[model samples]
Target: MASIKAQAHHQRVRIRGYDVDIRTYGAGARNVVLVHGIGASGRYFSRLVDLLAQTCTVHTLEMPGFGSAPKPSHSLDMAGFAAVNCDALRAAGIGPAQWVGHSMGCQVVTEMALLAPDLVTSVVLLSPTINRGERNAVLQGLRLAQDCLREPPAVNWMLLTDYLRAGPRWYLRTMPKMVRHRLEQRIGGVEVPVTLIRGGRDPIVPARWLQELAAARPGAVAVELPGQPHVCMFTEPARTAALLREAASGQ
Candidate 1:
């Protein structure tokens, strides 16, 4: 994986009334767009992009408020985010490209597919958090309690700051909207080939959800990375890139 600073064509492009930061690498004929999860930026896909660039052109998007990008004045919801991506793709001259999204980005990609199915050739979802209602509340409670007791000072401090930025009020307001945004409903409507990626060790999004999602779609395929966690893209870049390439090639 190439470092973010080392990518030659790294630059910011204006899209959907926002300044979107994008990195383009390789000269392959097919174009692939990568989207990152919440509180993260395109840099998260640096390693995967470096590997996939060898076989296809790769474009990583830095959404508003993440990475070095500025936050928008208006609220950043899933639909708005998807529209921004659609506009960005059109502005960048990328058409009918394979959309690869991780976590929250997966929701965004699903929304985009719903809005403009023709603009997306296929989708590759990594650790998709679709059915929040089915999440293990007891496990979440245990993890919270454990983190409160054993987290290191530096890590705890960072967590505190993040919580402050993402205040209780903000979380309360945002979660309901996010929870109600149904990806499963959209999945059934997506006409393109869909591939779901799950981490074997992921606690957030269970393997069952992926299985159910794959089964809901006629030709969808699901792949699980053994011993990997929620951040499987980083932990299994080679495998993730392979899946992305397969989706891009329509194989």
Candidate 2:
């Protein structure tokens, strides 16, 4: 189990007429923003937040329809979701922070970097999802199941619980958008530094795809955690947090 930090707290703020929930931790000079994947909430980043909070101010978002954030009147597409998060960040007085995202969260942050370059210092994509080559939902599900088999039971539980909390209807509604976004095109437009972190055993995000994603962008860096599974950040918070700190510091 990961150590719990006493400093973590939740903040509710409205952005673009939608209520956004942010979990904040630590109070260091640097700012780090965490974006959770589809069917997930800020709670998914609990361990990572606790670790990073030790050295940097960290803000993890519950992207509108997920976690405790109220469900919107209508579902927002990938870009729309990213835009809302951008507004939430600005409203919270954050500017140019290191953006760290997990799974589908990577698409959200990547879209944010493209839409509002000045607001992002850098980007970290952890076990990024929806590989363009295998966008079919059935195929993705199979790969996810395969990856889950390798991940620890705790990580699988965390994922299942978060997915249930996100609700099946909303997750299904958001699936197409996540699959259709052209990450290759979008990533090409991001000028800030980008880092790709993936578990060596992540079936959803294969090593080849990670390499391809990094290659698509001029200076993007790809880091793989050998023997790790899809939810590497959740299972290896200390090591992952240190890598994030290094990426944030450009080390």
Candidate 3:
């Protein structure tokens, strides 16, 4: 099933001045952490949340400056963001499970795996963004605009709401930090198992980048879901959840 009417228990964790909002679902043994991309909230992955809830406990995190989490005093670099987020999650007793991230969230979790190695046992990167080949604001914006033409209305609406909530100042302030990170280079530093996934139709993350990332890591798994957009987890929650379930199974 692509979705289910699962109940989410919301809670806020305050760690080292960072307020983290987490929505918990399911009571299964396997645990999965869902981290949304830049300018997005946990709601972006609601479909996947519900689907995964059926078979595993899902922790949907709203990072600082987006969603329910309060904005920070200043924009943080990838490493800084990773430290704050991982500290909060670890404080909340979450870790040693599959840490899945999308867009810039992918960079954050990968950094977390390196900084707080104990908190992340495995990492799943979905449509990781700011391709080193096209890392400028103009190019990134153009790619996003192009992808919008193919996105479903619901997906666009969700993004609209989340973007508004994040506000332009914060989003712009963090944009450069995201573009500056070298995810392809950092992925190599991650000691834990890593899985790379992307929607086949995603323009922001090209297939060549995914292949390059996989090639650099001998054991990494790369998957491409046909006919899906950047937010494939929302469009094909059941299919993505199956991939996640397989990832979590090894944990």
Write down the lDDT that model 2 would get: 0.84
TM-score per candidate: 0.82, 0.95, 0.95
Which segments of model 1 are wrong by more than 4 Å? 2-5, 135-176
Winner on lDDT between 1 and 3 is 3
Ranking by lDDT: 3, 2, 1
lDDT of model number 1: 0.72
Model 3: ten consecutive residues of lowest lDDT = 1-10
For 86-175, candidate 1 gives per-residue lDDT tens digits of 887777777778889887788888888888887888899998865555544355445344534543344345445544544455444444
Candidate lDDT values, in order: 0.72, 0.84, 0.85
Clashes of each: 0, 0, 0
Off by over 4 Å in 2: 1-5
lDDT per residue for candidate 2 within 1-251, as digits (tens), equals 14444556778888767778987788888899999888877776777877777778899888877888988878887799999999888888887799998998999999999888989888999998778789888898788889889978777887799888878998889888888888877887888888999988888998888988888897888899988888889878888988887787772
**Model 3 misplaced regions, further than 4 Å:** 1-6
Worst 10 residues of 2 by lDDT: 1-10
